[model samples]
Target: MRVVIGEDSVLLREGLVRLLNTSGFEVLAALGDAETTLTAVEEHQPDLVVIDVRMPPSFTDEGLRAALVIRRQWPSIAVLVLSQYVEEQFASELLSGNTRGVGYLLKDRVADVGEFLAALRRVAEGGTALDPEVVAQILVRRRSAPLDRLTPREQEVLALMAEGRSNSAIAGALFITDSAVGKHVNNIFAKLGLPPADNDHRRVLAVLQYLNERPK
Candidate 1:
């Protein structure tokens, strides 16, 4: 896949370039500021953009605004937003339109190569990949009855599910058998009123429910 990287940190930017290259991605350009990044996208029109949520000048939301503009102007290009902190509002904004080819992940997640690369590939292939931390934060303050219908374990499983984890991944993370995870998933879907469907459809439904719910 072809990619453009927009990050202000020198070390991180270089590291990302190396990582993507090593992972078989073609890095078109590694840029520092938002404007150059935007220009690069206009010029190269890469398949994906890996950008930090903050960048030069104000160092607060510049990269994010640029990313939003890129999505609006060049919707064909996938975007993966990396941030140190979880911004529910920012994540919601990126997901405001079609969730396809959009991602919001914590910078810390990059340390986990397997997870990070999987998220990147998913986004590049026109899928949603929100950070697990982001999902947890969004669902944290809610106390709705439908959600309450889910047991605590089910709730945890749903959170990871929203992060695009597979049944095996969830099982490994929670140190349980895959069959147990599968049961929890079915219960979650039933409790949330999600009918049987393909796993991706179910995932989108569950995530949309979590995103659309009002915090109590």
Candidate 2:
């Protein structure tokens, strides 16, 4: 997969290039700021963009906003956002609709090569990858009676789903196999009274339902 990287930290930027290259992904360009990253992405049109949630000029949500822009402008390109912290609101915004090829993961997740590569591949293949932390944060504030029926582990899986994570990413985060994660997802939907569609889109639907019930 060809990729464009966006991050302000020099070490992390170089490290990501090296890591993705070593893993057989082509690094089209490694940019230090979101502005250049956007330009590079538009010019090169890489298969995927791995960006930090926060980037230069503000160190806040510039990268996140840039990602939103990319999603709007280039809906076909995949995006994977890495952050030190997982904000529920940000996750919601990123996964606001049925947008595919999107990811929101914590920075620490980079240390797990298997997981990170899996996420990259998933996004590249037009799937979603989300950090378990983001999922936990969303679930913490939601008040769903059906969610109460799940076991803690199952709940964790459900939260990961809300964050747009795939079965493989959830398995990697939870230290389980993808098959086990699939079972957990099935149980979650069954407990929540959702149909057995087995589509990741259903996960987003479930999240939106929970978000709608919360007192925003």
Error of 2 at 38 (Å): 0.7
RMSD of 1: 14.4
Give the Cα error of residue 188 in candidate 2, in Å: 29
Model 2 TM-score, all chains together: 0.65
Clash pairs for candidate 2: none
Lowest lDDT 10-residue stretch of candidate 2: 191-200
For every model shown, what is its TM-score relative to the native structure?
A: 0.64, 0.65
Every candidate's lDDT: 0.83, 0.81
Output the TM-score of candidate 1: 0.64
Off by over 4 Å in 2: 141-216
- Give the top-scoring candidate (lDDT): 1
lDDT of 1 by residue, 60-80 (tens): 888888888888889899999
lDDT of 2 by residue, 1-216 (tens): 999999899998998899899998999999989999999999999999999988889898888888878887888999999999875555666776545899988987668789889999999999988888777776664434355678999878877877888889999999999999989887766555454322346576667765554345
